[model samples]
Target chain A: MRVPILSLGEVLVASIQDALTDRGWRQLQADLLAQAGRRPPPGSRRKTAPRGVVIDLSTMDVMDSYATRSLDGIARMLALRGAETVVVGIQPGVAFAMAQLGLGLASAGTAVDLEAGLALLAEQVRGDGRHHGA
Target chain B: MAVTMAPESRLPVRDDGEIVGARRAARALAATLGFSETDLTMIATAVSEIARNMVEYGGGGEMTFAVIDGDGRVPGRRGLRITATDHGPGIPDVERAMQDGYTTGRGLGLGLPGARRLMDEFRVESAVGVGTTVSMTKWVV
Candidate 1:
């Protein structure tokens, strides 16, 4: 499934709502990175690119090692584009599996879910959670 | 030592699609055996890794699922047992391959070791140019 990238002012959101196949995940990575730091598409009123990215994985039930490493890589690449990436909504079961597997999102900011993830990104940018919503 | 009493269900795993199928089959089978939610996730995840390894490096293979039962003989050893066999080039050093962070492909090298950690019983048999077979059992507590 091709995930739609939504914008929340300066933050971009990619909510994965389906069970991902390999081809599906590769496409998602490409789509997110392609828009990470690029300027707003032509004919838009926004003057700035996304300052942060929120990847919501609440709907994801299973997260294997390959997907874990891919997300870690995406986080680092997003940093290179000047966008801080927060991975949120990791399912309890998936989190347990990842821990047992020794997989981690070492370089990215992690939170319980979308709300917490955005707050984390906000704090990183201005040291205040309220700043991003302003 | 546990005894498996049910007939085994076998599936041919040739690609990513089959990998998904194999794991889903695992979940369904485990649920029927009354495995807890957490255990179901663990079993499915382990099945995925081993199935992926079969496709990525082992040149595709066959996966089998068997339901183990105590039958009043083994007590709480009832659970799900899985075995994956592949015809692709096998591992040269099974010990090193079983270590965490060891990989011969583009993966994180967590396939074998990570799957091993999730299951209760795990073993691997391989010959460099011959093939590889992995067997794992996740017993319900």
Candidate 2:
């Protein structure tokens, strides 16, 4: 199934609510890149360029090597396309598991929650001198 | 030396979807054994890694889960054992494969070693032209 990707001004938010297959993850990567390339929604005067992408994984209880690797790849791919990526809402159990597995998402910004993720993204955009529509 | 095997269930690992299924099943079994939330996640993660390896590198395999009850020394102790086996080309170098950051696939090379770290007991047996089998166990404290 496709994970929902929501656009908030200059950022794209994807909340992964389930453990995704490799195909599902590839779809998400494609969708995120495609969404990043699209123009800002109508009625918003923000720049057409996407400044950041936030991936929320609060509901994900398991993140194996494959998922971790895919996230890392997606973050790097988005970066190459001029969009910063933030992974947020990693559950404590998942964190412990990842740490034990020696898996790390080093390429993406991370936050403890959605609000913090959005704030981090906004801060990044502002620091880069980009305009995030109100 | 001699351990009695409890009832077990086998799951096929054919694709990424099956990997997720295996993880869910493992988590459910672990929950029945009263594993904590953290332990549940850890066990599930280890299951995912081994199952994914089976599907990816091993060309598909079967995963079995069983409950092992302690005997004389440690009475009333219970643990879950997961075994994954594949009749595909096995690892040529088990030593290198167990090292962190060694991967033949498009992964981060954490599957084998990482799964080993998550479980309390880990064992691997593989032959180059034959197949590979990984067994891991997590106990309830």
Best-fitting candidate, measured by lDDT? Answer: 2
Per-residue lDDT of A118 in model 2? 95
What are the RMSDs of all candidates, in order?
A: 3.1, 2.8
True contacts kept of each: 0.72, 0.89
Error of 2 at A112 (Å): 0.8
Q: What is the lDDT of residue B37 in candidate 1?
A: 77
Worst 10 residues of 2 chain B by lDDT: B1-10
Per-residue lDDT tens digits for candidate 2, residues A59-107, read: 9999998899899999999998989999999999999999898888999
Instruction: Estimate, for each residue in B1-141, the C-alpha lDDT of model 2 and write its tens digit.
Output: 335668899999999889999999999999999999999999999999999889889999999999988844686688999999999999999999999889998777888999999999999999988999999999898
Q: Per-residue lDDT for A21-119 in model 1, tens only?
A: 787778887888888778987888887788799999998778898778878888888888878889999988889998999888997888998999998
- What does the lDDT read for residue A46 in candidate 1? 83
True contacts kept of 2: 0.89
